[model samples]
Target: MSLINRLLLLLLACAAPLPATPSDLPLKVGLIGLDTSHVIAFTGLLNDKDNPSHVPGATVTAAYRGGSVDIPASINRVRGFTTTLTEKYGVRIYEDIAKMCEEVDAILLTSLDGRTHLEQVRPVLAAGKPVFIDKPVAGSLKDAVKIFQLAEDAGVPCFSSSSLRWYPGVVEVATADFGELRAALSYGPATSEPHHPSLFWYGIHAAEALFTVMGPGCQSVVATESSGAIVVTGKWNNERIGTLHGIRDGKTSFKVTAFGTKAIVEQKSGGNYAPMLREIVKFFQTGKPPVPAKLTLELYAFMEAADESVRQGGTPISIPDYLRRHGQTR
Candidate 1:
């Protein structure tokens, strides 16, 4: 070979990229929805090392652009968020969800439309990948129950939650030594979506916060509408009472007040996505869900029962009956 040709070949070899060592690479995460801002927020937090709140260990490598056509909020923003994920984060957009699942270690179902989550996550569970479904796990309580069952049958780790559950104050109050917890009240903005049951859209955040301090076992629920807000009262099997105010009139914010035998603590601030992302990464890495499926089922049942109360003209609705309608024994 000519001397100049040999030198050119050596230069090419020097410029080649190095293969990533196993430990040097992060866990691959795929997104199943692009309609919500979470697509960009979560991707940046995971992929951008320079980010101040960056959560290490998992990186979003692929996403499927799934959006609901009937929902304007969903379909309209899908393209914009999809572009941001592709251009800014260098995330590969896949047209097929199953194909995307094959390429990633875990999945984030962040679709804005609750009605579409069950269908969107079907492929991810089938691929045996752990998945995190965002707020309002499903369009209905029935679908939510089916989702957990499906995930269990598939032997895939799956969890769904609202970021509000981790609000610093909420966490503090929940874990505080408030001897013999009595009852709690959580209030937040609850914008309704025609396609979903009341509280499934925005009120879910407050519902989650309520359950965080209250801890399931809610036996009955009743809802009353007044001054542009829906007020829900729940009776726990322990004889503890919890109330939720889905604010719709004005000045909406997230606040949780826990009453106990010793003290009354409140969380008056909003939530951040970073904390939830950290938990998601930990779950993806450990293959264990932070939130229990049974607890989640009860939470959804509580919300659905509130809706049922409204439909029955403020009659108290039994939580167990709500779950039973979905064929859940609990």
Candidate 2:
């Protein structure tokens, strides 16, 4: 037998067989968003009427609570989306999250703001189903940690991402064997979701790209905003340094660069969504979390603590103490 086959046999020698693709089977996917606009992308997907191209084999099937009623208008964007959702996806907006979770095998929680993720997603986790959270996973590091830990303990997978992370160049750089990567620089459009979570929600698109390639163990980070431009500097084990820029009105609208002692690589994969979805499908097939939930929580740890510093007159905060106080200093 070939070396590959022998290795595979040895690895799965006593493991259980994987599941058959319920790919073509009628899978029910629910979307939890106050504004139907969030689900509109999938609703009008490829003009196929069923979002067949992306979610192949699985049907979005049902969408609930197509409208937001209880939340204050100051925080709600659901009004503008009702018509599109009803006309495009035939989704019904329900008030109770428990009821919503019971009806679907999987959920797409696209709440209007990051602050609302914890309240909305907890029920979904308790229901024991997989979830895909749109960026800005949670409002705080503590909350993000709780969310992942809950899902982890429950054996329910949750994933969140940005299109930029999968851009061709970023993927290529990620494959590098950088020896002690000294620094990484990633740039993206001005984050519109800053009010809820400054660079917390959207910044991860760039941060996650770096975090993935860096392979975790980020010690702390500091960010400075000058005239609405965010300049983020971070350290990993106090050895390698990285920067992430969220700039407005910049012509060089996209870039991700990684550096090493022996090699350097640069690539630009701007605004790609297909890769994000493809990864999710892979997670379902393998029944595994898409990325290191622990690592993701750590990145959130950085963002949350950094934001606190920003609020405290640019004072630096130690993420380790914060995590340790919460008993999460892993």
Candidate 3:
């Protein structure tokens, strides 16, 4: 079907009847992320009275993310910020970090990426609580395993994902049982910031979608010889695949194709945000994480292999070492 024709059908399906709210839902959430910036999406979902459905039975009365570092700012500045968030967005802000985690049933780490996530997530893990960590759980491989393994040892339900995992078309293609796989290519855009850890930052986004469709445990990675545009290729289960062209200018996009002995199927997706939030909420309802701690561990390993390959004059890097050595074998 044509793109516009497909979208029209999607619009009709989306217009289907909305369901009534279930009463036995979980209560309260403690959000941890920088206030008023990128992580604002969580605040928008939970506190924005305008979005009543997401906030029902869920009150982020305690907000602890970026504002905490600046001590005076955390105390004095937050009151004013909370006023705006509450009055304008209806999100209640709490000053106490320990108190917030203790009081709320679960925690949402809104500041999804970078070095700070390790420190921020530490407090949550230390408390022995379930967490919905945003993507790129950690910038480096060691830290990612440390954080995730800590959660595993603590026996807490820690989860993370890009809404890309929930792309309707992608889900359909992956589930159709397309005979034997051959090769696949997936890709998306990136900022002009090349060496700014951009690969570690965003490449995993396309990686997540690729791994989800093909099933994880990707081994032996090679980078683009000329562009070094963070392109990666490897084997997923029994199939050979590639992730194309990051750090380019264009609308963000991802695709998954299964080349089978019998038939070929492809799925293209552009939006991945709402589905991510929906998955987190679903984990809230059911105590199972969509992506397990071990799966996230392998994701980190995949990116680490990319780094190793880039450093070794773009030689293909094997994924048998590092966290793969200590990774869960179960």
Candidate 4:
């Protein structure tokens, strides 16, 4: 070949993009449920290379369509989400969670029904893979506690949370230089799903926001319910108070007010799932949970106490007492 031709070929080779090496490969993640919109949203951000907000180093490669057949909300939407994940994202659909776990490095338990989370997560934990359980970790507080306990026993890193906890404003409030927080109030919409507990369905968003600012150590909860709203007041171990307002009527938004020694801060949620997904990827890579198991348990206890308080006619329910009654201790 002519020298000029050889030089041209060399230049072309140099300009060509190199294939990604093993070290540069994205983590293969598996989704366990296709009943919720999160399955599509999360997969879109992780798998779409053209997305501006894409969090690199992870891709959802497979999913299992495990939806509750009895619940119309679950059964109705499963087919659409399943098709999107499979057709749009090129994600392989699995017949069961166990089979999907075998092919992925980590798991996302995104089942819409909290009642199925415990069973869905058992095999994943047995495989010793990290998992992120979506809100309403379980249908009841006892089941939620049991799921965490199983994860602990299996020595697998597992955590549950609502996306509301990672809202830009809410996160800023928790970490800002607002001095020691004396009290806090969080408000959000609460739409109940009859299959689960009243607050577990949608009120979890407000509860998560409240706990994000207040931290743990909720001593007791007093709840008052009416047609328009349900107000839950929690007293902390240190005597600090926090309240969650679950609005059932009119327009709704997620907002919080924190009263601190140095400054008072009011935060309005700018909802985005990318931030939390980034944290989830980090947790998978490191095998450490971003949120501790203890705090999550306490959060569920607070929600359960609120339900119990309403049942007892707006009386104050002790957190410790509620936990003990449910076969859990703090």
Which structure among the candidates has the greatest TM-score? 4
Q: What 10-residue stretch in candidate 2 is worst by lDDT?
A: 66-75
Each candidate's TM vs. the true structure?
A: 0.92, 0.80, 0.77, 0.93
Model 1 per-residue lDDT tens digits across residues 106-157: 9999998888888888888889999999988999999999999899989999
The local distance difference test score of model 2 is 0.67
In Å, residue 13's CA in model 3 sits off its true spot by 41
Q: Against the correct fold, how does model 4 do in TM-score?
A: 0.93
lDDT: worst 10-residue window of model 1: 265-274
User: What is the Cα-based lDDT of residue 135 in candidate 3?
Assistant: 64
Which stretches in model 4 have alpha-carbon errors above 4 Å? 1-21
Clashing residue pairs in candidate 2 are 64-92, 64-93, 65-92, 65-93, 65-94, 66-93, 136-201
User: 179 in model 1: Cα distance from truth in Å?
Assistant: 1.1
Report RMSD (Å) for each prediction in the order shown: 4.8, 9.3, 11.9, 2.6
Task: Specify the poorest-scoring 10-residue window by lDDT in model 4.
Answer: 321-330
- lDDT against the true structure, per candidate, is 0.89, 0.67, 0.64, 0.90
lDDT of 2 at 132: 83
